[model samples]
Structure formats: C-alpha cells, structure tokens
Target chain A: MMSELDDDLVARAQHGDAAALEQLLGAVRVVAVRYCRARLGRTVGAFTTADDLAQEICLAVFHGLARVRGPLITYMYGIASHKVTDALRTAGRTAVLHSLDELEGRADISPGPEDAAVAAELSAQLARLLATLPPQHREIIVLRIMVGLPAEQVGAALNLSAANVRLIQHRALAQLRPVANEILSEVNP
Target chain B: MTAHHDQHTEPAEVQHDEHLAHKLATGQPGLPQDPLSILLAACRDDIRAAENPAMPLLANAAHVAVRGHRRRTLLAIAAATLVSGGAAAVVLARDAQPGSPLWPITELVYTEHADLALIRMALGDARAAITQGRYTDAQIHLDEAARLLTRITPGTPAQQLAAEIGTLRQELAAHLAAPAQQSEPASQTPGARAATPASAGGTTGAPTDPGSPGQRPATPTPGGQPPVPPGRDRPQPGEQQRTTTRGSSRPPR
Candidate 1:
C-alpha cells in the first residue's frame, strides 16, 4: 500500500509537484541513510560522517532528479548507491582510517555472537582478498552483495552493461572461492 | 573415510557456489543474524530520512525554478536588443554615399578581426609564460588580451573568437594575479610580432618574413631582448627572391 502511494507521489514530483516531492523523499530517507551507514560504518567518525555523506547523496539526488526517467523507488536507489560509491572514492585513505578507528572505539554497536564471529572472520579474510581484485570488481561485488542492490540496478547506477555486471560478478566470486573454502575449512574443522 | 570425503568434496563445492550466487542475488548473507538485520533496517531508515518530504528537496526545486526564469528573461532581452540594433544600422547605411565601403563598419570589423587574432596570439603567449613560470609577463599579456577582446564589435567573426579568447584570458589572468610561487628562470626567444598591414597587402619593400630581425618585437622577450622585426632579409638556401610588382602600384590612402 505504501509502495503504491510512493509511486503516485513520485509521478507527481516528476511533473513538478513540490508537495509530492517532499512526500516521496520522506518515504525513502531510511533506506538511503542505512545504505550509506552500513557500508561506511567503519568511517563514521571521519571528517565526513556517514550521515553527512548520506545527506550529500540526498542533496545530489534531489538536484539530479531530472536525469531519472524510471519508477521513483528504483531511481532513488540507483542515485543513492552511485552517490555512496562516489563519496567513498572521494573520501580517500585518511577519512577511511578515521572511520575505522571510530568503529573500533564504539562499544555499544557490537554484532550478535553468532554473526559477530562469522562477520569478524569473514571481514578479515575478505579484506585481504579484496586487495587483490580491481577497484571496479570490488565495487560491483560490494554493491550487489553488501548493499543488496539488484544486478540490473547496480549496472544502471555504475553505468555498466548488465552483461558486464554479470561477468564482473562471476570473476569476483571465482576469486573469492579459494579464500572462502580455506576459511570454511578452518571454521568447520 | 573415503566415502565421507567424496560426499563432502562434491556437495561442499556445489553449496559454496550456490551460496555465492544467492549472496549476489539478495545482496545480503543467506544466514540472516540480528546485527545484519539491524543494519539493514537502519539503512532503510536512513533512506527514509534522506527522502523526507519536508526538507532540502523543496528548496532545491525552488532554486532551480528561479534560475531558469532569470536565464529565459535575459536571453529574450538580448535577442530583442540585437534585432533592433541591426535594423537601425541598416536604415542609416541606406542614406550614405555610393562609393563608401559597403559597410564602413566592416573596416572596423576587419580591424577587430586583426585585433582579436592578436589577442588570441597574446593569450597563447601568456599560457606559455605561465607554464615557464614567468608570472609577470603572463599578467601583462593577459591584460592586453582582455583589453583587445573588449574592443571587438559584437557581431563580427572576431567577436566570436574574442569570446573563446576571453575565457582563456580570464584563466591566465587569475593565475598571474595569484601570489608568486617558486620562480624558475626560463630561456627566452625573441618575440614574434604579427605581420604589418603593408606587408600583408603585398606592398613593395614590405618585409617578406615579418618575424625576422630588424623589426621591433611588439612585446618584450623573456630575456629582455626585443623580438626580430618582420620582413628583414634572411633568405632561405633554396629560395629565389622574385620581385613581381603587383598591388604596389595603388595610390596610398
């Protein structure tokens, strides 16, 4: 029901209805912030906070709405993902390390026992393996897996062809396989 | 042990591959734990906050609308001014003497062309100066270039070229105006001046090579040596000097 209302509101916004523009943004704000926060959590305490970066993404989307020509939810997600990726690229190493330091300092945001063990182990292994892959391949994998974007939408946001997205996905998985197997064996044994 | 090993190897490979594909599809882990769920939920909240109807989006729309209206109004006024100015010029031209230049304004226009070309050449020289770290010379060339461009008549070919030259001039000016960075001394060549109108018109005794020595450099060279004067004699090895007296017979204006 909310989805239907969101679509209608977006349509009105597209046609220059400011009231509807506000309503559509209201519906999508949570999704936008969370997407940014999860991926950028490690850098939360940097010069540009995850929330600040998220706001930048929102401002970029608001101004860039005319470039979109699809369903509002889909377009919004695409814009959000692109902005987050751009922000990460622009933030550089100092910002990233600062964010990671913040994450380390935070005591209240710990993962659950089961997932914590898995995530900690996986994140450590993945970090090492990720250094081996090209930036483009790493980005596609992060967008598709961590960010939970559909391959088609990921391709659209990244300005990649769908076929290219699938190829990158295949290669990224193939690269991760050996590492994943090693980690699994160590864990299960 | 052999049977158990075989069972584990094949199924494990299949499961791992499938899990990867599933991860790609859902953009999340197959094992959904509480922390991951919390993070995903938070992301959803962030998206909602970003999209909040009462915030920055409305302000952005208003700003764009105002800018668009102002641009349209400016464009309309400029178009009307050009049309009216051209009509008045045509009416005034019809009342003038028969032998007068088709457009007396055209001579001014031609002069403008030469000036624009000179400005463009000067700007190129300024860019070279900036690259060589001669900030003072670059500033002087940039100012002259701007003044030359400003003198151009608005509807001529030179005017169009002036617009392009103006942008480059501004950039050069800004760099020159900035505080001097570390200065590296550059080797200077004698300046090259534009061809004089007399030589360009094929007048007798006009310098064949306007860039030759004996002609004064219009701008000071980097090493303080004046540029070679145009049309001074320095004959190439294989070229013959043929004096074919053509347009030189015309009476001087």
Candidate 2:
C-alpha cells in the first residue's frame, strides 16, 4: 500500500526534511482531492469546491504536521473528513438560502446540454445513489473505491478494523445494488 | 462491541457477503459487470477524471503550504541553534557521516545538503552502468541516487538531479524496450517449459528464501504514489477473497 512509502516520508518529515515534508503534502493533496471529489460529486462548482477544500486540507495538514503521531494518511483523512463535513454543511445552508432563486444556480447543479452524454449522466446518477447511503457507509465506499485505499488503510482512516471495513463495504454495496439496477432499468427502458 | 453485535446477528452470512462485496468493489477481471459494479467503477473513474485537471492547482497549494512551514521551521531551528551555541553543533556535524551512528542526527538537523555529492557520485555510477548495458547495476545506482535525493531540499539542484535521473531512466527504457519485445514471445514459451522443473526445484530447495520470491513481484511499483487497483491486491484480507472469486465455478463471461 502507498502508506508503506508514506510512513517513510513521515519519518523523514518528522526529522525536518523539507523535501520529504513537501512530498508528503503532495501525497496528502492527491488523497484529499480524490476524497473531496468523490464525496462532493458533480454538485455546482464541484471541481473548484473540491480543489479548494483539498487545498484547505493540505494547509491543515501542514500546520498540524508537528502534532500528528499516528499514520499520516489516517491523520490527513481525518482532517479531510472534517473539512468535507464543514463544506457539506455550508453547501446545505447555501442551498436553503438560494432555494428561492431557481433559474441561475439550477443550471450549475443540473446537467446542462454538454452534460447530456452517457458518462456524465451515469456519474450524476451514481453520485445521487452514493448520497443516499449512510455517511459512514458512503465514506467507507468512497475511500475504498474512489480514493483507492486498501481495506486496512480504509479501516485505519475510518477507525474500523480491516474485517469491519470489508463487512461494511459488502453491506453498503448490497444496499446500492438494487437501487443501481433500478436506475439502469429506467435508463434503458 | 457494535462489530461484535453485527457479527453475532449475521454470523454465517457476514464472511460470505464480505467476500462478495470485495469482489464487486475491486472489479475483479471477468466479473459480470453488475450495475453496482458498473456504478462503483464509474465512481472511481469520476475521481480519476477530476484528479488530472485539479492536480496542478492542488500541487501549487501544497507547495505554498510547505514553503510557509519551511520558513517558520528555519526560523525556529536558527533560534534553537543560536541558543544551543556552536561548539556542540560543530562536533555533531563532524561526527555525522554515512556509516557513523550519528548519521541520523544529520537528518534531524536538516543537513541533507551533505548528501548532494554522494548523490552525484551515485548518478555517475548509474550513467556508466547504463552505458555498459549493466541495467541492473544502473538500476541499483539509480535507486541509491534517488534515495539520497530525498534527503536534500527539493529545489533547483534536486530538480536538476531528477532530470538527469529521468534521462538515464529514458535511456534505460530505450535499451530494454527492444530486447524486451524480442524476448517477450520467446520468454513465454521457455517460461512455460521451465514452469514444471522450477516448481520441482522450488520444492527441493525449500531452504531457499520464500519471502524473497513473494517480495520480488512487489518491487516494481515506485515508492510514492497512492495504491493503484492492482496494488490493492496485496492486502492480506483482500487476497483470500480474490483467490476464492477467481477460482469460483461461476460461468465464464
């Protein structure tokens, strides 16, 4: 797993190696971006919003690096989890505030003419499906599949045992399967 | 406790379902492409697509964050050094060498600039080995150089060293590509030919290192990147599920 290499980087960074610190932050950026995008999906300004959140997560890790004692990946993801929740909470508030302004912001969230393609529609559909899952399940699934974390690392990030991660993953996908199939049927029909 | 309760509630089904879930999540080859599987794959693709465009901006942000931290760290270290004074610092600096036990202290003090010459020497060895078609030797030197490069500050000098390493890597690739293509078809047949005898020899040579063979397949992946899908195959719990699914009697697609 990447965490094996990351452990080495963390060791180096802790010793005050600036290059290693930078490299460690780079890896954190990748994970943060993947997690944010995966969690946020194609909501209005999803790309920019995810990038901004990822930047915040990176800065958070940089400022907090000295305090981190555990696996850096787990620490970084914990920060990412918090940042994403904050963003989602803010987005929720904004959505309610703009509920009256239907025309302008609607285009941003909705699939435009360019997004009429199959892949975009499929991603949008899947994003909605993912949103319906419980938070822990959704987070586990995203970290496992989207962030491509191994079950052990996913367990570490989520504070579950590896066995628990696998079990939760199974149950979560089992829940998604019927809904996903129904959506496919509707699209085809 | 919750995990215990869940296990108690679904003792028999949990393991089997976990195995199946792992199979579907991993998109194991020859899977039936069920809708959930497709959606999972789509979800992965979505992040990957976003990753490329956003990488540069994210990298810049990381750079800015690190640079700011590095400055603050430098100021702190300078202040510490001023307080600690020069005599003991000189003694430690003089003591820290490649083989010395105090070598780690050099790392702690951020004195990795000392490794620059060693990196250059390693790079020279790598380049000569590359020229002589000693690819393995070149790889060894390159690995050493890269390891040393990590110690130094990542700026212009390090970037130049990396560029040189890249050039050597390209040269190494070019040398291997032709021979590799020629050997590919030939190796397969001979590999098949040797398979039985190799297995027989392996059994006879059981005293030979078992861990080496297991680790050999894992060495090619470079050190820094996140776990790719194939790399995800290495986790112990996932391995069993993978083997079981692959060996299952499900109809071939």
Candidate 3:
C-alpha cells in the first residue's frame, strides 16, 4: 500500500501533472531496485543487474499508470513482482548470466577486495535461504527487509493481518538461523 | 520442516539461535562486519549512480499519440478526398460549361498546370474588366471567385485563397462607390455601364482608395503589405460636387 504522500503524488500524476509523475517514479525506484536485487539471485547479466530490472519495472509501471488507482506503492510492487517472476522464468530457461563490474556505464563497485568477496558470499547464502522459504514467508521477508515496509503496511499490501505478518516473519527468520550458520561455518572453518 | 531440532538444542545454543533470528528480523548482523549491510550499501550505491531513462506522463503521451494518429487519419481522408475529387474534376472539366459549382472545388483542390491555367484565364478576364470600368461584369467575376473559394476544402491553402478573395472584393466595391475618383491607365476609358449604387449603401460620399498610388484598385494586392481595410477608406466628395452619400454597401457576399 502507498504512504499518504505517495497516494497524493499518484492522484496528481493521474491528472496529468508531469512533476508528480516524476516524483512518484522516483519514490518507487529504490524499493523496486532493492526488490529486484533481492529476487534476481546472484546472477548478473545485462538484464540481471538491479538497475536493469528496476528500469524495466519502472517502464511497466508508467505504461500501466492510466489503468490503475489507489496506493501507488502497492500497485508498483505488484508490477515489480510480476516482472521479477517473469525474469526468473526466463532466466531458468536460459543457462548463463554473465557477471559484470559496471552496471550503468561507469559506476564503481566501491568496496575493498575482502569486503566485496564477503558480501558476495553472504548474498549467495541469503539468496539460497530466501528461496527455501514458503512463497508468502519469502514475500514477507523481502517486503519487510528490502522495501523496509512496516508490518502493518506490508499486511495492507499483502491483504494479511499485521499479526499474521509478524508470525510468518518470525517463523521465516527462525528457519534462516541454521542456514546462515552453515554458510558462516563453511567460510570460517 | 525442522521441529525435531527444538528437542535436541541446549539453552546456550537456543539463545544464540534467538540472537541470530532477532538480527534477521531487524535487518542486522551478529557482528560489526555484517556482509548484509555491505551488500545493501553496494546495491544502493549502484542504484543511486545508475541513470533512469526519462518518461513523460502516460496521459500526455497518450494525448499526443492520439492526436498524431488523428492527423494521419485526416491526411488519409484528405488524400482520398482529393483523389476522388480529382477524378470527378477531370470528367466535369471535359464537359463543364460556364456555370458549374464543381469548377470551384476543382480550381481549389487541383492547382495543377491545367487547373491553374483555367483559373488564371478567369481571374485575368476579371482584372481586364475592372480596368475597362465594367463594374457589373467585374462583380460577376468577383462573385464567381468568392463562391469558388468557399468550395475549397478546409486547410491552410484555403485560408490563403480566402484572404486574397477578400482583398479583391474590397477593391472592387470601393471602385463602384467613387465614380468621380480618377484612376490609373493613360486614357479616359469610358465605362460600359453606369456605376449603380447598392439598394442599401451607407456611404454619404464617394470613398477614396486612400494611399493607393494614382487612385488605382488595390487588386493583385501588394505582398508584405496588409490589404486596405474598407473602414480606412476616406469618403471624399467629388472635386466639384460637394454632395455626399452615406452607408457604403459591403462587398458582395
């Protein structure tokens, strides 16, 4: 669901305000980028980078802007989810996703060699752990962590009660502990 | 899926498990060097630096696209209108006598060599009649040209032709109202018919074609100069007869 601010921006954008359109798109860009990062796995190709996937989702959001109304973020998340799912299916059929250093022309990865290697291992481990969760639990973890959505808001977005969101999230994290230890133990030992 | 582990774990390890679960829920790490935080920061940096292609509002894009689509549709319609009209004009021009309304559409739509040739002949005859002071004959030609202008399809060219016809009509009307006014041409060309006043005219005196050099009709109106607005013409009484008339008649509709 949209925050009150996003809702207002969406309404203005629907009425043909160009500034509001840009603002609404900007608000969604980061969340959509994080969501794409979380869901796209460790594979990095031209279509696999968070930025590439986020651009795709934003284009889809703008294309469907006229047909939708209400909480802008939820509507956009739906688009992101659909695009991510489609990308996953396509990636499954296609074998290789090449790794890349630069995403958008000239952006440094910006971390030391040790920090980058550790981060990559953790990302691979987290991707596996997230994939193991039930779809609903996985969605909760992503929305809660990646989008930084509060439980009440996530509940509103997913049509689940706030209590249900907390319960599912607790169980998901409980399941995550042993797997995280396994990855850490492998690296340390 | 792992309920059997609950019975096997000791208290210290249970606390450790709780600590890890708590960290995951809060997006934290057990140690200061949390790789999750590192991953998040790197992704955020990359995303922030990457440029997004600009997009216009959907409604604006749709409006422009729809308008462009409409213009394409209209052009197709106009091209079809011209083609059908051209074919019709060919048949009619072959058989057209003096008083055909189809001549107007043909003259306006197809200004090809043949059509321009025919229209020029008619306009040239009208200009000749004006120089000869045949007001009635000139009025007939002006009336035909005016009527033809109305038949042209609504577009830019039609507007330009309409403006030209407007200037010609104003010049002809001014000539009819001010018979005493001397005109161009070296000879005293006797008028074929008397300049008759319209049944309802507002001019109380003869109107001069004010500022027109040598009192000539401003027909074949000068380029880069505005046509003489009828209101700008001064009503001058003849040099000898101080008598005036009122309520100058407007140019022929």
Best by lDDT: 2
**Per-residue alpha-carbon lDDT of model 2 for B1-253, expressed as tens digits?**
1343364446456665555545544555654578877776766765666354223442333233234453344335434543443224323333333322222223224344446655776778778866776555565566667766776677999999998887877666565443434433433454553564543333332221222221111122365321111122223344334322212111111
- Could you give the DockQ of candidate 2? 0.17
- Model 1 lDDT per residue over B206-234, tens place: 33323222234333335322222233222
| DockQ category of candidate 2 | incorrect
Query: What's model 1's TM-score?
Result: 0.35
CA error at residue B10 for candidate 2, angstroms:
7.8
Reference-based lDDT, each prediction: 0.45, 0.57, 0.48
**How do the residues A1-189 of candidate 2 rate in per-residue lDDT, one tens digit apiece?**
245326778777666665565466556767877788877665442355566566666555655566678877788887898878888887898975534443453454444566535545655776778877998888888887777677888887878888788777777877887988888788778
Model 3: how large is the Cα RMSD against the reference?
24.2
Q: Write the per-residue lDDT of candidate 3 for residues B72-99, one digit (tens) a residue.
A: 4323433444454224323333332222
Error of 3 at B38 (Å): 9.7
List where candidate 2 sits over 4 angstroms from the true fold.
A96-112, A115-120, B5-29, B53-55, B58-253
How accurately is candidate 3 docked according to DockQ? 0.03
What TM-score fits each model?
A: 0.35, 0.50, 0.42
Window of ten residues with lowest summed lDDT in model 3 chain A = A97-106
Can you write out model 1's per-residue Cα lDDT over A1-189, one digit (the tens) per residue?
134224466567656564455455444543454456555543332212454455445444444454556655466666666766776676664676755655765444454667455444444444555556787776666555555555555566567765556666666666765665565556568
Candidate 1 stretches greater than 4 Å from native: A1-10, A16-41, A44-48, A67-126, A185-189, B1-253
